[model samples]
Target: MTGNARLDLAIFDAVDIDTVGAFYAGLTGWDIVRKDGERFGLRTPEGQEIEFQRAPDHVPPRWPGQEFPQQFHLDLETDDPQAQVERAIRLGATRLADGPAWITMADPAGHPFDLCQADGVGPVMRLFAVTVDAPDASELARFYADLTGMRLVHDHPEGALITDGERNLMFQRVDDYNPPRWPDPAYPQQAHLDLVVDDLVTAQARALELGARRLSAGGERYRVFTDPADHPFCLVW
Candidate 1:
């Protein structure tokens, strides 16, 4: 393992950038740390960075459906799951489901997330895991484990979770999953990940060797590649 890569940012595409940015900032109590004409961003207190890009005519995904399946979802940990759910509703989240351990909610932009119960009170929300939908969870998990040098932390029949020291990523099997086509408006990549590397050439070579296909060269500083499951991720130096 190179051990030289780290997750730099998670980018979301939203139809209304300001509204989505405000929703997340209010929900996480994070300030807008970066902003430009087309993008907005926030850095959580725990150092996780997220950015939103404006996508004109974007159609929010309909989770658990064939129309536009949710390619990914974030899991947030809360000491008081119910209370957190209530607060999120006040911040424009719609509760989709509630249970003893986890509560599902959709954000203002219709991205699904889970408020999972935790042992103690901490930040209003903590970035727990970014879960991706795949036809073969085991295969995707192994591919990322090799690419990021993260260890497999949790294994289930239909899913698996992996973690580097700083970030956690999960993969879950989705029935009849419809993968997004890059730069396709009808089936857009709702969100994507950015990984920072010290040497882009070395990282790109290793990624191709480990089963990633080059989709586009974003620029001298960034390049886009798709994982085995067709999810796009950028390797940046």
Candidate 2:
């Protein structure tokens, strides 16, 4: 993997699988790739991956002993943030925040995503990478290599980190990585990460078998699903 890497955020949570699928599939143009009872993936023209998890009836987070700070957020880049925000809202992304610095919205599953103005280009944004969110660092790191047909690069026992032949992403670990709440009048979900794939159908199926929770979001040539951890990410072709 090179130093330059684009981003496809992977958010964690235990929420409705189809709900998340609708969130991302509506926001990004990623098509549904595979489908199972629970797990699935949204495919782009290329093959990137995101997923959701169905936890054991989890509870939503409350920071400040009442309202918790947003544990994590997906950062998206675009030429026009305002236009994108409008599109997201129209496509079902609930507006959590709308500020000049950034616009925060949620997927169907209630994860926060940010459409902030680019902070220039980071050391790893010019290339391609799929950001993964996971509890186990080692397992996800290895998973990226296998999934991307590449090898592991750096080792971050604190979290999962991997790289494809040309790009890379950090499998971030958050002790309080409680996914945001969606559909709540008080606080809605923020944003979602998008992925790309070569073949939406095959990739979506593969993801489902790997423990992804499929959503009702179906595309003629793609699919969408959530991973075991409940993070909403997608694959595209």
Candidate 3:
């Protein structure tokens, strides 16, 4: 892909687009940029976009388990995690787990995300990272780092982190990791990514060489592919 693919959008599947979009909008204070019968889109203050697609048969992931795995999740940072956790609960989130400096919660659509305590001054709530579950964190991190040209800031056996200065993509080792079977609602891809590229053909070829499998489903303007870990991502122009 010439290592120039830009991670454009992070997308999640939801049965009720409006409810899921409203929940995240209330939690993050992001503006709802687009909403239609088929999809909903929200934009972060930094201009990063998160989209929800209509999936009537969408199946929610089962976090902390491999049977119906949570393939990906967002990590949100805030100065006061406790208050944010409360606010999120009031906004229709259910507390999943708690830690000293972080709290895990499931959104209305059953997507698991974290409210982590941040050290520096910033927005009340900001997206800190988008973490993906993988059998080998280092391997997945390396694949993305090579594809997107994101700098690998941290590399370990258990986990890995990569950033493009503005956005962070993390990978964590999951025990008995179960990859999604896309195009199959029973084993739905709870979330996926959209990578923007200047040339679709070139990017698709390079991505295939980097262990991405091109999927049969795609539109003329975009093509779908799965990463090394079977996480569905798109190459869009």
The candidate that achieves the highest lDDT relative to the unseen native structure: 3
Better-scoring candidate (TM-score), 1 or 3: 3
TM-score top scorer: 3
In the order shown, the candidates' Cα RMSDs to the true structure are 1.7, 10.2, 1.4
Q: lDDT scores for all predictions?
A: 0.84, 0.54, 0.88
Error of 1 at 97 (Å): 1.9
Report the lDDT tens digits of candidate 2 across residue range 1-237: 221112353434545666666666666656776556566566544455556655435344332232543444455554566777888877677777677876767655555676666645432212234444456656656554555555567777576556554445656655645443333434433334455566666666666656666776657754555555455455655
> Could you tell me every candidate's TM-score relative to the true structure?
0.93, 0.46, 0.95
Which model, 2 or 3, shows the larger TM-score? 3
Model 3 misplaced regions, further than 4 Å: 121-123
Error of 3 at 230 (Å): 0.5
lDDT of 2 at 5: 17
Candidate 1 residue-wise lDDT, 79-162, digit = tens: 888888888899898989876799989888888889898886477578887888998998898888888788988777499998
Candidate 1 Cα errors over 4 Å, as ranges: 1-3
Identify the superior model by lDDT, candidate 1 or candidate 3.
Answer: 3
User: Residue 44's C-alpha lDDT in candidate 3?
Assistant: 78
lDDT string, candidate 3, 57-94, tens digits: 98887677888888999998888888888888999999
TM accuracy, model 1: 0.93
Residue 234 CA displacement from its true place in model 1, Å: 0.6
